[model samples]
Target: MLKVCHMTSVHKRYDGRILKKECVSLVNAGYDVTLIVTDNKEDEIYRGVKITSIDFHPKNRLDRILNSKKRMLKKALNIDADVYHFHDPELIPVGIILHNKGKKVIYDSHEDFVQDIKEKVWIPNCIRIVLSFLFKYYEKISAKNFDMIITVTPHIVDKFLNYHRNVHMITNYPVVNFEDRKNNKRSDCNQICFTGLISPLWEHENIIKALNIMKKDDISYTLAGPSDEDYIKKLKDLDVNKRIKYMGVVDAIGVDIIQTHSVAGMAILKYSQTVGGKIGTLGNTKIFEYMYSQIPVICSDFVLWKEIIDKWKCGICVNPNDIDSISKAITFLKNNKLEAKTMGENGRRAVIQEYNWETQEKKLLALYAQIAGERVL
Candidate 1:
C-alpha cells in the first residue's frame, strides 16, 4: 500500500478546507495517510486522519523560530511514507532535507508569500521587504527540488511555472454538498452579513461607513468572525455601532443560520497595496458560501472578482475603498428586493454549475494520480 505524509507547521486543529478535503480524498483513494501538525501537544486522530504532533523545547520567540524547523525535519525523517507532501511554507527546509534523502516531495503553495508579507503589520516594512525577497528566492530554488508543485490559484501556478515543470492547480473550493441548506426568507429588516477573519485588510470600516451612510434604522449588519482587539475597538468606535452585531467565530452551521436571516453577503475587501497583490486572483471562501445560502453578494471590484460577478450576474460589484460606492451598492440591493433575490439565485446556479467542489475534486484526484503513478479511483 502507498503511504503519504502531509505536513502543516501551525494549526490548532485539522479542519480547514484544503486539509479536510485532501485527507478525505486520499483516504478514499486507498493511501495510508499521516498528517503531521503543530500545537501544544500530540494528538492521535483528527477527523479520521492519523495525526502526529511534536514535542519541542523553548516555546519563546527565538526558540520557536529555531526549533520549529528542527522538529518538522525530525518528524519528516521519522515518518515511513512513500511521499512527503508539505502544505505550509515553513516546512520547505524539511522538504529540502527529504529530497536530499531521495524522497518524493510535493510543495503546496496556498498563497503568494511575497504579496502576503505586506499585510503583516507586526513586521517592520524594511524587514518584510528583505524577508519577502529571501522567501521568493528560496521558494524558487526549493520548489524546483520537489517532484510536484500544487497551488491553490493560477496566479500561484504562474509564480512557480518557471521553476517547476510539474505544477498543478488545486483551488481551495468548498466541499460538495456541504452547504446544501435551502434558503429561508431573510429577516424583515435589511440584513447584511460578513464572514471570515476580521482584519483591517478585510475593510470592515468601509462596511460600517456604508451602513452609516444608509441611515436606515431598519437595516442591521452581522459581523461574524473572530476579531482582533484593536480592530474590534475600532469598530465599536464607529458611529454606526448600534446597527452592528458581533457574532464571534462560527462554524458552517452558524454561517447558514446567519445567511438565512441576511439579505446579502458582504465581500468588501479594500485595495491596499498589500491586500490588492495578495488577493488579486484569489476567490474568497465566503462568496461561495453566500451563493450556497442563496443570498445576494456585494463584493469589491477586484479584477478576478469582477470576472466572476459579471459572468454570473450574481450580485453587485463596487469599489470597496470607496464609502459612497459601497453605500450605493448596499442601498440598491436593499431597495430592489426582487433583483436581489434573482441575483442570489443566479449565484447559486453558478456555484452548482461550475464553482462547486465536485468539479474541482477531479483535478485534485488527477494530481494525486500523477504523483502516485496510478488512478486514485
Candidate 2:
C-alpha cells in the first residue's frame, strides 16, 4: 500500500475535515495512512489510520506557533512516509523542508489564511495588514515547492493559483450519511439550532436578540460548540429569559441529537469582507449540515450562501446582524410549518445531489493518485 502521513499541530486528532473525512477516505482507499496530531493520548489505530500523539500540547497560541510545529516536524521525519500532507499554515516550513528532501508534500489550505489573519482578534490591528501581506508573500513563494495544493473553496483556489500552478479545490462538505439523522419527529419543534465553533466570528448575539425581538414564550434557541468563558458569559447576560442553552463541547452524536429536535438551523455569521463575507469565498459547512439533518436554515445573506439558498430553497437568507430581519425569518418558518418542512426536504435533496463529502472524496482520491504518480488504491 502507498504510505501517507498527515500532520497537524493545531487541530485535534479527530478533526472533522482531517481525520473523519480525509484520513479515513485515504485509509479506505487502501493507503497506509497515519496522522500526527498534538494530543496527549497514546498512539493507536482508529478507523484503520495510525494515530501518533505529540503528547506535549502547547500552553498557548504563542507556544503552539513557536514550538508545536517543530515537534510535529520531528515526528514527521521519523515517519519517513512517501507523502507528507500537512493541514496548518504554521506547518509551511515543515512542508518546505520535506519538499527540499524530495518528498511528496501537499499543503491543505483549509481556509484563506491570509484573509483569516486579518480577522484574528489576537493580532494587533495595526500589524494585521502588514502580517497578512508578509505571510501572503511567504506562502506564495513556498507553495511552488510543494507537489500539490488542496483548497476548500473556489475562491481560495483562485487566490492560491496566483501562488502555485498546482491547486485543487476540495470542499469540507458533510458526510452523506448524516441524512440518516432526519425524521418526521420535528413537526412541533420550536427550537432553533447551531452546532459548531461559538465565537465572535459568528453573530451569536444577533440570534439571541432576534429571539427576544420575536417575544414568543414557546420558542427557544440552543447552540453547542467550543467557546471561552467570557464570551459565553456575554451571551448568558443577553439571554435574560434563559431561552438560549449552551451545551459545551458536544460530540458528533450530540450534534445529531440537537439537530434532530430543531425546527431551523442557524449559521448567521457576522458580515465582514475581510472575513469570508464575499460570494464564493466561504463554504460554511453548517448550512449543509443542517440540510443533511433535514432542517430549514437561517444563515447570512452573503451572495455565496444566498445562491445556495435561492437554488435549493432550503432556508431563509437574512442580514444576520439585523435583528428585525432575523426575527422575521424565524416567524416565517414558525408560522408556515409546512413550507418550512418543504424547504428542509429541498435542502436534503440538494445535499444528496451535490453538496456532499462523497463527491469531494472522489476529487481528493484523484488528486492523491496524481501526486503519487500512480493509482492510490
Candidate 3:
C-alpha cells in the first residue's frame, strides 16, 4: 500500500481547502495518508483519514516557526511513507531534511511567498525583502530536490517553470455538490456581504465609507470575519454601525448561508504591491461560492477580474479604493435586481460547467500519478 504524509504549519484544522479535499481524494484512491497539522483542540476522524495534531500556537510568531519546524521535521523523519507532502513554507527546511533521508517530497506552493511578504505589516521592509529573496532562492533549490511542486495558480507555475522540471497547477476550487437550497432564496433587504479575514489588504474601510456615502437605509453591509481590535475599532468609528453589521468569523456552512441571503458579494481588495498579484487570480473558492449562491459580485477593477466579469457577465467591476465607485456598484446591483440575478445565474452556470472541485481534483490526482511514475487513470 502507498503511504503519504501531509504537513501544514498554520491551519486551524486539517480540513480546509487544499488539504481537506486532497486528503479525501487520496484516501478514496487507496492511499494510506496521515496528516500532521496544528491541533485545533477537537480531534476526530474525517472519512477514514488519520490526523495527528502537534500542539502549537499559530499566533505566536517565533513559536509558530520553531514549533512547526521541530514537529514537522520529527514527524517526517519517523513516518514510513512513500511521499511527504508539505503545504506551508515554514516546512521547507523539514522537506529538505526529509529529502536527504531518501523520502520523496512534494512542495505545495499555496501562494507567491515573495509577493505575499510585502503585505505583512509586522515585518520591517528590509527584513521582508531579505526573507523574500532567501525564500525564492531556497524555493528554487528545494524544488529541484523535491519530487514535484504543486501550486494554486498557473501564474505561480509559470514562475517555477524555469527553475523546476516538475511543476503543476491544481487550483483551489470548491466542491461542486454543496447545499444548493440557499441559492433559491432572495432576501427582502438589499444586503451586501464581504467574507474574509478582516485585514488591511481586504480594504473594509472603503466598504464602510461607501455605506456612509450611499445612505441607503434599505441596504446594509455585513462584514464577516475575525479581526484585530484596532481594525475593528476603526470600522466602528466609520459612523455606519447602523448600516454595517459585524458578524464575527463564520465557518463554511455559515458563510454559505450569509452569501445566500445577500444581494451581492464583495471581493474589494486594495491594489497594494502585495495584493495586486492576487487581485484577478481566478480559482479562489470564494468567487465560486458567491457564484454558486446566485449572487452578483462587486470586485476590484483589476485587469484579471475585468476579464472574468466581462467573459462570464457574472458581476460588475469597480475601483476598490474609491468609496463612490463601490457605493455605485452596490446601488446598481440593488436597483437592477433582474440584471444582477442574470449575472449570478451566468456565473453559477460557468462554475458548474468548467470551474469546480471535480475538475481541479483530476489535475491533482494526475499530478500525483506523474510524480509516482504511474500511468494516468
Candidate 4:
C-alpha cells in the first residue's frame, strides 16, 4: 500500500469532505492513509485511517491561518509520506516545500478561494479585493508545482486549468449505504430541515419568514449546525411562534435522522456579487444529501440546480429571496404528501444512479494511482 498523508491547518479532523469522504475512501482502497489536523486532542486511529493532531488549537481565525501552517509543515515532513495532499490554501507553501523535497503533492480546492475571499465580512472591502487579486496570482503560481489538483466543481476546475494540466473535479457527494436506500419512517411529515452552515448566506431568516407565510402551525423547521449567538438571536426573533428547532452542530448520524424524518430539506441560499452568486454546479452537498436521505429538497432556483430538480423530478426550486415563492414551494410540498413522497423517491433514484460518492471515489482513486505510477483496477 502506498502511504499518503493529508494535512489541513484549518477544518476539523473529521470534516465531512476531508475525513469522512477523502481519507476514508483512500483507506478503503488499500492505501496506508494518515490525516494531519490542528487540534488539541490526542492522535488515534479511526475507520482504519491514522489521525494525528498538532495540538495547537487556534485562539482565533488568524492564529490558525498565520501559525498553524508552519506547525503542519514540520509535522508533515516528519511523517515523510510518499504523497502529501493538503486541503487548506494557507498550507499552499507547505505543499510547495514537500514538492521541492521530491514528494508528490496534491492540492484539494474545496471552493473558489478567490471568490470566497471577497465575501469575508471581517475583512475590509478594499483589502479583500487586493487580497483576492494577490491570492489569485499566488494560487496560479503555486498550483504548477503540485502533482495533481482536486477541485469540487466545474467552475473551480476552469479556474485551475490555466495553471495545471492534471486538475480533476471530484465532488463531495454523500455516501449512501444500503440502509439509506430503504425508506425510513418520517418522524414528522410537516417538519422541514436545514443542515450545514446556518448563516445569512443560506437565507435562514427568509426561510423562517416563509414558514410564517404558510401560516401552518404544524409546519415546524429544524436547523442543525454551528451559529453565533447574535445570529441565533436574530433567528429566534423571527421565529416568534417558536416553531424552529435549533440543533447546534450535529454529527453525521444526527443530520441523517433530521433529514430522514423531515417532509422536505431546505437549501434556499441568497446570492450576491461578493459571494459570486451560485457556481451553478453540482457542488452543493446538501442537495445531494437531502436526495440520498429520501426527502425532497426545496432549494434556490439557480440554473444548474433547477435543471437537476427538473430532470430528476425530485424537488421544488424557487426564488430564494422571495418570501412568497419560498412559502408557495413549502406549502405545495406540505399539502401534497403523496407527490412529495414520489419526488423524494425520484431524487434518491437520481443519486443512486448518477450522483453518489462511488463515482467520485473512482476518480479519486485513479488520481492517486497516477501519482503512484500504478495501474488502477
Best by lDDT: 4
User: Positional deviation of 299 in candidate 3, in angstroms?
Assistant: 0.7
Candidate 4, residues 246-289: lDDT per residue as tens digits? 99999888998888888899988777542246546566688998
Q: List clashing residue pairs in candidate 3.
A: none
Error of 3 at 294 (Å): 1.0
What local lDDT score does residue 283 receive in model 1, on the 0 to 100 scale? 38
lDDT to native, each model:
0.77, 0.86, 0.77, 0.86
161: Cα error in model 3, Å: 1.3
- What clash count does candidate 1 reach? 0
TM-score of 3: 0.92
**What is candidate 3's lDDT per residue for 1-377, written digit by digit as tens?**
67888888876565466457888888888878888877655445678667777765567878788667886677666777878888888888888888888778999887787788865778999998888888888777777778788887666777889898888888777777744543555736479898877777677788888888775585888879878988877778884547778899888788877887788998877775443353456535666667777789888887767777789999988887788888889888888888888888888887777778888788877877765664122
TM-scores across all candidates?
Answer: 0.92, 0.94, 0.92, 0.94
Q: Mark the 10 consecutive residues where model 4 has the least summed lDDT.
A: 272-281
Decreasing TM-score order of the candidates: 2, 4, 1, 3
Cα distance off (Å), candidate 2, residue 206: 1.3
Which residue runs does candidate 3 get wrong by more than 4 Å? Answer: 40-43, 178-183, 251-253, 275-279, 374-377
Off by over 4 Å in 1: 56-63, 178-181, 187-189, 272-279, 374-377
> Any idea what lDDT model 2 has?
0.86
Better candidate by TM-score, 1 or 4: 4
